[model samples]
Target: MAAVETKALNGVKLKKKEHRNAYATMMYMGTPRDYEFYVATRVLIKSLVKLQVDADLVVIASLDVPLRWVRALEEEDGAKVVRVENINPYTGQQKRFKLTLNKLYAWSLVDYERVVMLDADNLFLQKTDVLFQCGQFCAVFINPCIFHTGLFVLQPSQEVFKDMIHSLETGKENPDGADQGFIGAYFPDLLDQPIFHPPLNGSNLDGQYRLPLGYQMDASYYYLRLRWRVPCGPNSVITFPGALWLKPWYWWSWPVLPLGIEWHETRRQTVGYAAEMPVVIIQSIIFLGIIVMTHVARPAISKLYYKNSDKTTSMMQTAIKFIEIWSILAAYVVPFAIIPRTIHPLVGWGLYFLGSIALSSVAINSFMLPAIQVFVPLIGIFGSLLVMAYPWYNNGVVRALAVFGYAFCYAPVAWGSVVKLLARLHVSVEREQFFPKLTESSPPSGVNKLC
Candidate 1:
């Protein structure tokens, strides 16, 4: 181990040593993709390549689409692309890049000794040569430090793969979450590493970081430290990424990313319409509940919640805030809905699901629109009663629930529909722009995004 460490360290100081140590950054890509997606990653790649011609780096994008996007990635200027397929061993779900990035990194999918796993959705706003400090074993920021299950820097070796796989088997996970819980739980400190970088570099797209050095560790330590406070001034890299597996517009609220379109295509291939109807039923209930709660319930009670009539907008905003819980819930539910259910009538419920999304255009809630579409329904009855007890809720809110309740009487079936329709829409998410209509020939005006 000492000899191996010495050899790896010898190559780190120079950019292009004769025996150059590899330093890789990871991300996945797909075909018929948003040009903006690669465009954004290019910003980071350009910075890394500028640091050295022989930086020993490439963007690791996953391939789950039938539309070969490899050529498109090759066509991109100033990028070295490696395509990976995220084959979910347990579920056999191939379209799960978000859940599998860390697995890829831990598996040493790239050649470099140091691998930085970055989300393609993030922009490299500034230079970040600092990530090179953690030589081998592992290199990553630990703020809010769980594996994040998305992005990081790694000292790739067979050991990481073994440890990660081991953690999953031995580490106690939520069963519902993903590899994230296991990442920190098992590794606690480095799996068997000598020195891992401090999380002060930052973690997640939200730019959440904490404390200073000497005792600097990633958020994993902080999490382990049980909210331990340390010192860290600015100078950390700013990393903003998509918050969830799917983009928001794709009936999944994650982002309207191109992968969902690919998911839709593959579903068609495997079982055709036969397997998709259940998803439609589930989606319809989720959507109907969202529309009624944000549009109807919260707006009606916002003034009361805040005890300030002067701000109807405030009421709208509060309504939206309360509804955010539902959106978050619906997000949690839909991905699991990809499995087929046996709904009596998949067709009608599917239409109801579409109606909720289409009606999501109504801005009665606020400029953000469709606040309740996700918020109210996502919450179960336990919390709903608390919100209802507040006296501020009025008729509009009550009426909205009444209407939603009637429509979603058979919510299980309706929920499947919502998932099915969004799956069919060819939905795509890039940054914050979500165009509801997936197949529109013309792109949305002013919805263009920067990487």
Candidate 2:
């Protein structure tokens, strides 16, 4: 009886130890990007589960993160939430990264034997279960001298957490006033550490080690070669540490960063786009209706523009030209407002193109403008997008110069299109034949009937 009881106790203890490691990410609120990052965090967690990683998925959310988002992370994404108070040790940080210091709470996860802290922008290419076997403090040196905190293995200790908090209170030497700089300052010697290689027998390591660049492959590297060729370690994860706007979740980043499609692909397979699909469907319907209605009612709309007097004709022409130009401008601006901010990039761009065509149709039909001439702005916008998205530019300087060259080449064509549009407007106004000639005998000389 005594031996059986001891065995049962040991079984319970072993079971408890099973969940001692977690793959962790942080979340905080009070930014316009809060929801974007929340969705990104969910995708990251779901991707980890999809990869069949052996460790628990954890979200170290701040107190202000919405309860609904927390529940979704817990129930839908299969992540364990650890709510921590937002740590604002640096009061002078930029608003964009103000809450990033909250990531320091990953060090307080004492229940986990090892935690692989991550940023929401990380895209895991495969299971990196071996990272759990690394030492108390292991990070990839994506830069030559700085170890990235985007993904790092850390052993949770109350003493360490307290020391870090105390250091914050006392003003640690943080250059950027964000978690990355503070943590980099905290572990300044990680660059000198030996590279971590998981033991074949799967035993855990004991001290800090430098993870190879393959683990935190920077997305910019792919822009140069259009592929990844990290020669060391397993190519486990990719991190987008560049401009905030180009983060993988944003739709505009798709063709600009081709790998963004991969992120959205994982999202589609896992959490899916149910949250934003309704908006996309409605927008599509509206655009299609505009295209059809404008085509069908072209004659009726054009008849309203004709006038008899020269002053009225000149004013009408000016008004029509202004409306056409503004309509073209609205075609470019309206789509950015209507498309769901976090919808898949392909869908967003599709809606944008469709919206541009649909809106441009109004101008095309009302003024009897040529379709090709009216769409010059749309064509120019597409050409500019292509120029900006070109992947082979040797550097940003070259990319900027290429864009300048394209704009320089395109300016004359744009001006010529405008000239053609003005000339076309003159002919249409003079002819007054955009619709069948008004049968009412021109409303008597010198008298104007404004429609």
Best TM-score goes to which candidate?
A: 2
Q: Which lDDT tens digits does candidate 1 get at residues 1-451?
A: 0011222222222222332333344444342334334334544454444445344545555554223444433354334554444423233223333344234443444245455565543323234444444444243334544444344555556565645544444534534333444454545665334334344435434544334445444332222111112111233343333553333113332112322232223223322354345666676676666666665654333222222123334454445445543544445444335422212222432443444343442332322323343323433332333333333334445644754564465466447645643332222111222212333344334322211
Candidate 1 has an lDDT of 0.39
The sequence of per-residue lDDT tens digits that candidate 2 reaches over residues 249-333 is 9888876665677789989998889989998999999999999999778656666555444344566656756776787678778
**Which structure among the candidates has the greatest lDDT?**
2
Model 1 is weakest, by summed lDDT over 10 consecutive residues, at 223-232
User: What is the TM-score of each predicted model, taking all chains together?
Assistant: 0.37, 0.76
Candidate 1 ranges beyond 4 A from true positions: 1-54, 63-68, 92-106, 135-149, 162-179, 190-236, 241-451
Candidate 1's clash total is 58
Clashes in model 2: which pairs? none
